[model samples]
Target: MEKISSENPSIEKTKFIKSKGLKDKPHNYCPGCGHGIVHRLVAEVVEELGIREKVIAVAPVGCAVFAYDYWNFDVTEAPHGRPPAVATGIKRILPENFVFTYQGDGDLAAIGAAELIHAANRSENITIIFVNNTVYGMTSGQMAPTTLLGQKTLTTPHGREVLRDGYPIKVCELISVLDGARYVARGSVTTPKNVLTTKSYIKKAFLNQIENKGFSIVEILSMCPAGLDMEPLETMEWVDKELIKYFPLGVVKDV
Candidate 1:
């Protein structure tokens, strides 16, 4: 890529244009939320892939339910934990459309567990962007299926008990075991390097669907400062020290 030298400063500033996938408007997410970073990454990938026109996002109930308001592209709402089922129907109806689901741990791993499993088992040609922030962000910081053992949440004031609460579900591991799943990976946005790797993972997941390879998913370990009741910097450190221990970052499966 060659740099364009122009006497007109206006044209030089145009070198960095806004991504068409994201809308230029105010966001409703709380301060220190990782959703904003993830949202930008998704939008950048869409722009890079040149599939903005053909993309259709399935937003389910959670912090990301109003994603349509932030994204410039087409989006449809699904019942709580029903994004996989909804994406399946939309993709089946219009195979040309690049379909994806944006869901959180509470919605994806808890309520919509069955739907996601079946979708992967059946090899649906769709992408799933799963954000795992440990605790439920929108609903008063409740314990999510991916919440770490011994971690405290609003619902688990005494900390999550391993004996009583069982173990956190490893979504990437579970989905990768399915023969129909073509790609599955886990990444985090706690660091700059990690953020780049997450973008790579997301790009691959989206490519799998665009190439008609089959089901693909990228589970992102995100930070939720408000939910955790910690400072923004503390939340980042906590993600590195605690969150990544349970959900180790890596490519679980990529066929």
Candidate 2:
């Protein structure tokens, strides 16, 4: 066995492995995908909070399918667009443990819209990490509910027409309007600065959950280079100009 290093220790080494919570497998997300960064942030937060053994992560379908392989905690796979409901069930049964859900835009904003809205409206004691890449990645680059207008996708070859496709759904803003949510923030992982800020927001969401602060969701504006058909570097620019224009950034609401 290779010797472990004490210097620059990671959550996997210091907390997860020590607590015997997560398994060992490299994540399966695509390169340049923000889900990996979000996963690491969640793992770090759970480790830092010393809750690796008491946290349960509900993994949703879509690109985040293998979340259980990455998180060093108890994880259950939820059906597509049902993470909120699944997380609610887990939190309701095990109130003492920390419960969180990892879901993508397609999973959370599309088919799972009702589950997500109801969970938040009910003030379910769960933390949600919502990744909004604007496209249905796992389903072969289809246009998602969060997809920006005039953006070309496999489903919208000429570009998403506003009149036909309607407008892109701003989930953070939508959830913020709900009375049950205690915190609602939109963040990104495109840069070092943004990643740090995103991590802080994620940690805060987890802390809110621990405090029983009701439903908390952090919507992340992530890049899907494969679907966007842009170079990795160019995708960040697209996110800034196009994605942020529609979704914007910052905390939409906190109560």
The candidate maximizing TM-score is 1
Looking at model 1, report the run of 10 residues with the lowest lDDT sum: 1-10
TM-scores of the models, in the order given: 0.93, 0.90
lDDT digits (tens) for residues 107-193 of candidate 1: 999999999999999999999999999989998799998888888999999999988898999999998888999999999999988
Model 2 per-residue lDDT tens digits across residues 60-127: 88988887777667889999999999999999999999999999999999999999999999999999
Displacement of residue 25 (Cα, Å) in model 1 is: 1.0
Worst 10 residues of 2 by lDDT: 14-23
- Model 1 alpha-carbon drift over 4 Å, by segment: 1-17
Residue ranges of candidate 2 with Cα displaced over 4 Å: 1-24
lDDT of 1 at 169: 95
